[model samples]
Structures are given as C-alpha cells and as structure tokens.
Target: MKNTYIPITMEVEKNYFETSDRMIKTLRLKFLDERFDFEPGQFCEFSILGKGEAPFGIASSPFDKAGLEFSINRAGVVTKAIHELRIGEKVGIRGPLGNYYPVKEMEGYNVVVIGGGFAFTTLRSLIEYMLNPERRGKYKSIKVIYGARNPGLLLYKDLLENWEKRDDIGTYFTIDTKVEGWNKMVGFVPTITEEVAPSPENCYAIVCGPPIMIKFTLPVLLKLGFPKDKIVTSLERRMKCGIGKCGRCNLGEFYVCNDGPVFNFEQLEKLPKEV
Candidate 1:
C-alpha cells in the first residue's frame, strides 16, 4: 500500500485568482511522477514545504490530463503561503484522499447540483465528469443551482459562461442581493433552490456549501420530496492528517478523510448534528 503520510512532489502549472477580491485562488499542479488518480468529491493535502499543509477538494475533472486543480481560500497560514506561490513553484500533494461522489450509482438518474461559495470545488468536478463527451450519456438531465454572496464572488466565471451556452445542462446563477448590472436571479441559495424546485423523481441531489446554507437548503430539498438517501452533501472539517489518524474530522464513528467527505442525508442523520 502507498504510505499515507508521505507527499508526492508536483509543480505548479497555473495559478490565478478565482474572484475579484483575490481571497480565493485556483492552482493547477502538474504531477512530477506517476499521477495519483482521483474522482469527484475527493480531496488532497497540499503542502508548501515548511509552511504546513491543508486539505482541499480536487476541483479538476478526472479526464483532465493537464493537472490537478485546487481552489483555495486565503484563510490562514498554509493557504496564505499557497496564495504567494507563483507558476512553476514546486509543492507537495499527499493524496486524492477521501471518498468520492457516487457517479456510478447516479447513472441513468437526473442530477441536481446545488452549491454556494467555495464549496463548489468538488461540485465542479462532478459536473465536469458528467458533462464529458464520453460520460454524458450515462446520466440523464443535469441541473445546477449555484449562488454566491455577489456576482463577483462566484468561481469559474469563464466556465460558468460556457456552461450557460450549452443546452445539455440547465444552469442557474444567483446572488444574495441584486446589483445594478446583474441580470440573473437575485436571492439566497435556499430561496433560489426553492424557486427552481427540481423534481425528485428518478433523480439525486448533491449539495455543498457553508454549514448555514446547507442547514436551510436541506429542508427545501426534502419539501420538494427528495428522499434522505437520495440527497447528498460533502462536509468540511478541521482535518490535520489527511489519512484520518488525527481524529479531528470524525463524525460519530466515521472519519471525514477516510470514510467520507461525501455522505447522503440518511447517512448524515446517524451522526451528530455537527454537519
């Protein structure tokens, strides 16, 4: 088995700001050795040598041969160090750690993707995986409901505009409040979700966002008749050792790094209300 504690070396392929504030940045890292394959909803331990490491979701699609992607918020030491990195800098990546979204199980079912703010990282992975030319036929209709504090805060602006032009997927973008030039929907995530009211029949809903947004959004999905088992979400926690030995990311008996960052509503119900 591969040693979970050791990190593989990678080179920073691309680095850019995802939002206007520059608080969140996106990194595309090229593998220096054999690539570590990963699926959507999985995360990696990104390290900057002496600065320490942090767990971030893999934001690129599995079929993306260019490199792995991570969209990180400039919240603390490790992330701040990461933000300072320039193109061609070397870095450490520990894993394609944690479980992934159930794309295999989602085959033949319509998918509803709901996201807010930075948590859209993995949801982007899921969307890209499903929308790939070879994989698109495995799933039915796909709809996305995404919101941010404002239009400027949304991630993947170029891709969002491109997706808006495609007829294969239904994309809805919203903001917390209206702005002068903003022509799209204006409302909170949960409110926009309720407005979309995607059908539960033959479908699964995947949600990821801030805890507060998730707390209210679940009820809207449930009210729309989605079964607990069919509604899924990814969790964020204070993870130290990406392999789950640190015990900081445990929810009941499960470790977010090992058993999941992904869990359905039925599975979440068995854990404490921390989620």
Candidate 2:
C-alpha cells in the first residue's frame, strides 16, 4: 500500500460560488501509480501549502474519473486560502479517503436522497452516480429532496433544473422561507420531507447535511417505516491524517476517515452521539 501521509499535487481547473461563503472547485489530478477510482461518498484531504488541509467529500460523480470537484465552505483559514486560489494553481490532495455510500447493496432498490445547505456536495455525487446510464437500470425510483436557506444557496442549479424536467427521477427543491420569484416547494427540509412522504418499502434513504437537519430528518425516516439499515448517512468531521493515525475523528475505535464518513443508521446508533 502507498503511504497515506504524502499527497499528490493537483491543479485547480475552475471554481465558482455556490453560496455567499461556499465555493465548488474542480481539480485536474493525475494518478499514474494508483487507480483514481472512488465511491460517491468518499472524500479527499485538500491542502493549501503553508495554510492547512481539510477533509472535503468528492462532489463529482465517479463516472467523471479524470477530474475531481469539491464544495468548500469559507469558514476557516485553509478554506479562505483555497478561495483565493486562481485557475491552474496547485494544491495537495491526499485521498479519495474514507468509506463510501453502499451503492452496490442498493442495486434494484428505490433510493431517496435528502440534503440541506452546502452539505449537498456528496449527495450530488450520489445522484449523478445513480442517474448514470449504466447504473440507472440497476436502481428503481430516484427521488431527491434538496434545500437550503434560500434559492440562491442551493448547489448544482443546472443539474437540478435538468432533473426537474426529466421523468426519470423525481426532484424537489425548497428553501427555509418563502422568497419572491421562487415558485417551487417552500419549507424546511423536514417539513417538506413529511409532505412528500416517500414510501419506505424496498427503498434506501441516503441523507447528508448539517447535524441539525440529520437530527430532525431521522425521526421522519423512522416514522415512514425505514429500517435502520436501509437509512444511510454520510457524516462530516474534523479529520486530519486521512487515515486511522489521527485520533480526532474517532468514535469508540471507529475512525471516521478510515472506517467511515459513511454509515447506516443502525451503525450510527451504536456509536456515541458526539459526531
């Protein structure tokens, strides 16, 4: 196995704002020694030299193998430095680290994806994967319930618009409060989820968002009769080493970076609530 500590240099190809303080950036990376294959919910440790590094989920689909994308929030020194980076600037990437969503197991089952705020990144990847021509046949219905504080804050507008027009998948978009010029669903994610009320039979629910959103959404999923194992989620944590060496992301011997970032509701139930 290759040493996980060292990082491969990749160049920033493009970047654009998703929210006032969040940016979605694309990177062009070359992995000659190892295959760059990764699952939808996996993440990479993005590093800006002399600044710092942070774990960000891979926001692009695995089908797009040549390039990588990340949705980063401008909340800290490292991300602020990342925001200043121009096209063609080089940065260090030490992943596709962490576990991934259980796409293989989900084959032949309906999938419902729920997301909120800027945390929609990995969910976007999962949606793209499920929508891929080769992969779509293996899955049944695909429904996405995505929301942010406002219309301007939603990520992947182009794709969402296309999904809205397509009959292949059901798409619903919402904001926390009603805004002028917006005519789609308007409510908090949990409320909108209750209204939509997708069935739990033979369906897998994958959720990723802020902690509070997860807290409230779990009950809704349970009330809908989703089994613990069928309800999956991806977690965000303060991860450093991108491997088990760092103790920061541990939850009772489970390292979020190496062991997870992706876990089913049953698995999460067994762990401490700190995450």
What is the Å distance of residue 87 in model 1 from its true position? 1.1
lDDT of 1 by residue, 1-275 (tens): 88888899899989999998989999999988757788899999999989999999999999997689999999999999999999999998998899999999999999999999989999999999999999999999999999999998999999999999999999999999999999999999999999999999999999999999999999999999999999999989889997879898888979989999899999999998766
Each candidate: how many clashes? 0, 0
Query: Distance (Å) between predicted and true CA of 3, model 2?
Result: 2.0
What C-alpha lDDT do the candidate models reach, one value each? 0.93, 0.86
What is the clash tally of candidate 2? Answer: 0
Off by over 4 Å in 2: 20-35
Could you tell me the lDDT of residue 34 within candidate 2? Answer: 45
TM value for model 1: 0.98
